[model samples]
Target: MSNDLAAQHRPALFHRAWTVAVIACLTIVAAAAFAAMPGVLVDPLHTEYGWSRASIGAAASVNMTVYGLIAPFAAALMDRFGLRRIAMTALVTIVVGAGLTTVMTDVWQLTLYWGLLIGAGTGSLSMTFAATVANRWFVRRRGLVIGALTGSSAFGQLVFLPALAWIVDHQGWRPALVTLALTAGTMIVLIALLLRDHPADLGQRPYGATAFVERPKADQGAARRTLRVLYGSVRDRRFWLLAGTFAVCGATTNGIMWTHFVPAAQDAGMAMTAAASLVSMIGVFALVGTVLSGWLTDRFDPRPLLVGYYAGRALLLAALPALLGPDSGAVIVSWVVLFGLLDVATVPPTILLCRRVFGADGAIVFGWVNAVHQVGAGAMAVFGGFTRDMTGGYGPVWLLAAALCAVAAVAVYGLTPTAARTGDPAKA
Candidate 1:
């Protein structure tokens, strides 16, 4: 990552790496569009199919789980095959999965299409894809790229949600889905045209690299490699602390906010479009926070930064109930700004920790950690739904997340890379 002659010879104004970042951003946005769809579709599916909130939420739970769980494997697969191939495959799967949702009658079909297929497709991209891209393409500004990729999640919401909500409002959920499928289909063409597996393919060294990085030949069986890393890393307390805090991150953000906020706002008498707009605004601000977090991660210890992020999130979640209710205004708008900044800000730091502790296996280890992230999201998704069904409000869910995030802040407060201390990543 040190300055080299390869860095000096870089394009003055335009870098191919930026092109790759743009493509990666678009890909994440497309996948996130599908991920965000569940929130809008939840009530409609419940109304039309007479499915309980818990049942529909269960499907969402499965989607989040698949999304997280597939990440490490996706990382390994991308290593074995290539980013372009895996990316196109994910987009096609997303299109097919979204298309299938149009005709789904049974909740099981929803689970099959939305939960498994779309989840897997989008999951293959998120954090793992970002980590891979940053690792392969750039040496300088690497954290910035990861931050951009993380922030792109918000961009996905900002770009897709309001329009999707409008479509659902004027047309129907099915048409909205058709629109989503087409959007994802377009990204397939984009990725096919732009994505590359590595910088070496383009006859360029990684940006800022003094020497050419030899692309590591991946061992056969991506799943085997993924699991082997997991098995080794799981014993480390730092991994658990990172995983534990990230779990809360998932629950507070994706689980409750992305999956439940719109519906909860609707239940509080806010218009769906209005609620969706606020969510989009959150994404818009998230871009700022996540990007700044990346910049900060590069300059400081990620551990303290994480504690602060979680602590801030805890305070925010605790205040969510009051902010969502009738007569909500300036307070809620202010809330969105803070929430957006906090959303996905945890990503850069968490990935940094994985890199510091796990070293060579950092990308895959991050993937496994992200799997827990989704599982946590999935758990809260279902629990949020069940809480809604039982208590007729999302207050309990908000309080629980607040409490958990508080715990996470405490859990990660003094965490350091024990593996780094021992000079052995496998030593717990």
Candidate 2:
């Protein structure tokens, strides 16, 4: 497998950068296979091992926490080692982690393999990876490239989950684990054979550049750089606002919905396959929502967009408890469609705000914000589990998440809408 892209002078009709973007999309899609697993796994493991949902949720918490925390460092690591090496490493790690889960007998193995290893692996390839690929490969249509990459996860979920749900329902949980690993393994081959560290690596400039620019030097101290960025960023009031709101975003979305939605539905007597299919529709609508949000972000003051997204999310979450049941009724279908629209839509606006407010360090700063987002997600993941065990239902959890989103809405409302867009970005 050669990570060697040839040095070519001008592209004839298409640029090689699009190839890299395509590869990036493939990788994100494959990673979503693993992302789809955790929530789906919760009940099946409970049925197979009699493990408490809280116990499984604890492992999920660790995974989200590690994934979030590892992200900023992973960006630095990508700089230090180059994108191709780091991506290859992450893919291999995922392959091993998802694969090894099949042999696990105890919860600790779940923690090590699924929680820690998969988290670390997937974190390294977060939305930051999409941004990096977009910014480095194409000077023109960068947002379009990023939006496509972000939307790729939805495609993966839509493409993978029905089949995955069928496997878990009919074949058992172990085979599903095998399936996720094989999906990631396929990415390993694609990345190794095709991915390059940078446009410069192939003696080319970024797409749409008029002149060739030398590849930037790699960072030597990845961890220190991430922390330094964090330390400097904490002083800004807007940074706190962004981070806090994003944390809530994490809590409501991946923490509770992604981790518990299927089981919560299943607990209400819905079939696992039906519940999983409903969740997959989330991916379908998320694609439409995210792309539209990106287009909206370009024209609107992102603060208002954030406010609308959070407010809508809060409303949907508040009504979530009454929606799930055995029948795939119109009410539940409506909820899934509406909720899915708001799911990843926060991203484009939040990203624009980060770049507008933080300037050159925006990506790194956003990485830290995303870390807090993951922490919020991790906490809520475990909290949902404990809430379920203690109360025998997830009703309170929904209301609480609703309240948090309301707060997020309020906080985002306080942001200076026009300032981040037009004013000089702060040095931080």
Candidate 3:
């Protein structure tokens, strides 16, 4: 009887793991759909409306800011209201925002639709969502699962950028926006049909927990709990260091580079398609880098991993200005390949650091830190454009980003090294 029951349970376990993979894939597609928009839209909006780069950048700034700011609350809300409901709502919201964006003529409308609405929607589905699902569903190979999901987020850029750029270049920007709306609307149906908030909802325990171990109680008053996590985190020096370093991470990568790289490449006489392809290449390398970073995080101290990443980023950014022109060839490609490897690779180590320092509230604390990261990114998105207008080139901005990375490299070392070992699987 016992052997028969064990045989029967194996397939059920496989089903649960399969469900987690599907949810992770859905999250990846949603992330990619929204993330690919800003870069593809930048040049078209500039040419079509004669909008200043600064004005267009401001809308991106708004999008990035709202995306970051809402993350913690969104995480809390998911915990309270359930993941499937929140995820479905987020998809619908994105559909509305992207669909409406196709018709906007004014800058503020662009900001309202793309910046605020789409930003809010995507915020709910960010890395926090992946972490939540990984934590709740998987016990074994959790690190690998989280890394895979994070890579999917980076892969979203790779999957969407070329097609999006092609659409904007040949068809029109409106069609690109419409395509995004439809993609998101399709995801809404998938989420409603398949997503489950927890494994327990399907009569399974988390993958690794002992069957006899009681499930942990859900936090009552998730909103208040989220606020307390942020407040308590503020009092910790390690939290500040993590947030500060990650803020620079956001500034250099998502803020300045993702928003402006294509335009800057175009300024150097590259085709829009070529520039977008280069950005997508970065996505490819970022996927590899982030997943490897996750493996490193599980085995080594994350502090050193982060230090190495920031140093690599600083070197690459410093080289960017010289590598921009059409004649640069292999040198430019090498620079981009290296830059992509370091792009969002900062995330896994950053997540590790948050878990180390904040313990039980690590995920929520990471949300607040991520908000600061976006704050930095938003500031740089607007400032990079303004700097371009002032200097007539992106050279100065690249140098500034390199300088920030250097500063971050030094700043990360100041974090409490004691925190580095916390929750390390190797240590376990």
Candidate 4:
């Protein structure tokens, strides 16, 4: 089909929906590959380079900060150029970063490869992709779709962590890097083959948008109105509340959990393989929880869900130190399942809430909110490492995390739908 003709023609029903699923899976798999690499590499890198845990964590902090910094820009870029192009670019960047990491000699090289390059790549592949897809796709199943997509990240971590750990153990971190690079490259090819920028780009309506009408011409005045909606969200109290809560979410999950969990387990005398397996177990439940969160987002007020997740997570965090034991396989397994399920599930609901609060500009607004999440995560990652080095234990850090979760649960509960005063941003 001619490009112009395809642009003007009606899309085949259900084709773009499938395309979205494929794209979500590919984007998430690449992201997961990168995310899983760090946890697996932490110990090996420390042993090989004689680096301090604080220094390694500092590198991860840089990566997470960059990851957050990229989110706002990523949203804007996606808004201007579209998701497919931006996502493909991100994937390519990740492949390069992963491939180059195999040859690193100094800790600085680690910072350059994993901290800067991989961070930027994964940042681009972050939750903003989930928000964009949910906002542009189905009206009815938006929550479920987003949930499944969010779950893909966890699923990626679950499936890859143990294998990557094994690779690092058997062949060193370099081989693991090569393996991840291959996985990312393979996904990039899949994305190129199947992904589309939008349902409209494929000549079909969004799965649930009732009528596919051409947007009104945007003269300067109408353009200002659109910009106002985007800016107005920044000024909303509820936006800040949601952002704050998500910041805690980042601190808990990516910061303490992904960045330090493996090391912490080791400190408790757990073997490397056992720690990785426990983390993998968390990934399994994270997948299930994220999917369920998406389903509930479509059916109930997201505030309560956030409350439940954070509250439960706080209790688990409080229990962790007491429950932690080298031979307590069942206890560790239970912790992994409970914690993993709650980990990233906050994402879909947060995105849904952003759309309800920001309308057409939800992606960019979410970009900003997600930035807060990253910052919190980055701070925790660095702090957790420092605390461990200073005190020779993770107990205090886990306690702090529990406190943060409680604060977040309270903060999110304050996010009333009418809190924006514009009422039901879905209509905008």
Leading candidate by lDDT: 1
For residues 66-163, write the lDDT of model 4, one tens digit per residue.
Answer: 88778767766666667778888988888888887778888888789888998999888888877776666666578888888878877786667788
Model 2 per-residue lDDT tens digits across residues 194-282: 98879999888889766787887888888898888888889888889999999999899879988898889978999878888888898
Residue-level lDDT tens digits of model 3 in 130-210: 777766776565666667677777777565788889998889999988887887787887777788888777777777554
Better of 1 and 3 by lDDT: 1
Lowest summed lDDT window (length 10), candidate 2:
1-10
Q: lDDT: which is higher, 1 or 2?
A: 1
**TM-score of every candidate relative to the true structure:** 0.95, 0.92, 0.92, 0.91
lDDT of 4 at 231: 78
Candidate 1 residue-wise lDDT, 149-233, digit = tens: 9899767855578888999889989998888788888889888888888888888778766677777786688888889899998
Off by over 4 Å in 1: 1-13, 417-428
After superposing candidate 3, which stretches have Cα over 4 Å from the reference? 1-15, 212-220, 417-428
Q: At residue 92, what lDDT does model 4 achieve?
A: 88
Clashes of each: 0, 0, 0, 1
**Global Cα lDDT for candidate 1:** 0.87
RMSD of each: 2.9, 5.2, 3.2, 5.2
Candidate 2 Cα deviation (angstroms), residue 408: 0.8
